[model samples]
Target: MPRLLGVDIPADRPTIISLTYLYGVGEKTARELCHKAGVNPQARARDLQEDEVARIAALLDKDYTVEGQLRRQVSQNISRLRDIASYRGMRHRRGLPVRGQRTKTNARTRKGPKKTVAGKKGVKDLR
Candidate 1:
């Protein structure tokens, strides 16, 4: 295993893939990072020299936030939404869908479980 950005990358995976295991690093960004650090995309994690790993870590620290930094940034984004009091922000505060998707059918995951409507009975209570 190679240590990059304080994370142990699996030995068998290529450097590009290994870097993505870190939080907030996706496949596209990983490839870009590898290029910026002058690391071969095809290079295996275990084959990486210490200096190469350090270069990669330095690039990540400079350009992107991972692990703890990424988490804090995400929390800050949510906080901003709460501050704005926009329609979407209201959805976030109420724990509903932020987008304008119809709640009639889909979006059950966010809209939560469906409620049974009493057909013909109208608004009558079952008791």
Candidate 2:
């Protein structure tokens, strides 16, 4: 594995693909990084030379917000929303879907497992 910005990129994968393992880096950004760093996008990460790795790292540090920086930025945005009491922030704070997904069904991922209420069947039986 090639360590870039404190994250180990998979050595067996193409450099462009491996770059996606870094947070905030996707296919397009990876391609752009390769172009700017003069690194071969198709080259496996393990085959990269020290200078090439340094170039990539330097470019990332200078031009991109990634890894921990990106994570903190996103969390800060969410917290700002929460502080302002936005609807989306409320949803996030309540652990509910924030994208207007129907909660009538198929929201178990956010709502967690069902908490079934008892006594309905017993009331019907008594009647």
Candidate 3:
């Protein structure tokens, strides 16, 4: 197992893809990190020694605000939205569409499942 940013990468995957398991690192960032660390993109995590994993982790820690810092920043952004009472915040409060999307017929994803009205049962004499 290769550990980076305190998260372990499964030895089964290639080194490039495995690094994406980190909080802020994605495919592009992973590739960049691999390039920076002098690690082969096709290399497997299991093939790497602890020092190599440490190097990548150190690189990320030195250069980026991930881990705890990112979480705090994201939380602060959400808090700002809530504090402002803006349209987006109002939409959040109401559970309605927020991003200027037409909700007349669409936006079923955020609105959740539609409720079907019950039809009249069979009636005699058209009553």
The 0-to-1 C-alpha lDDT of every candidate, in the order given, reads 0.84, 0.94, 0.83
- Please rank every candidate by TM-score, starting with the best: 2, 3, 1
Comparison by TM-score, 1 against 2, better one = 2
Q: Highest lDDT, which number?
A: 2
Residue 79 lDDT, candidate 3, scale 0-100 = 70
User: Model 2, range 1-127, lDDT digits (tens) per residue?
Assistant: 8999899999999999999999999999999999999999999999999999999999999999999999999999999989999999999898788899999888998878876777655444555
Backbone clashes in model 2, listed as residue pairs? none
Q: Model 2 segments beyond 4 Å from truth?
A: 111-127
RMSD versus native structure for model 3: 5.1
Supply candidate 1's per-residue lDDT for 59.
Answer: 85
The number of residue pairs in model 2 that clash at the backbone is 0
Model 1, span 1-127: residue lDDT tens: 8876667888899988998989899999999998888999898988898899889888888888797798899888887888988777788887678788766677889877765666645577779
Q: Give the range where candidate 2 is weakest over 10 consecutive residues by summed lDDT.
A: 118-127
Model 1 / residue 86 / CA error / Å: 1.7
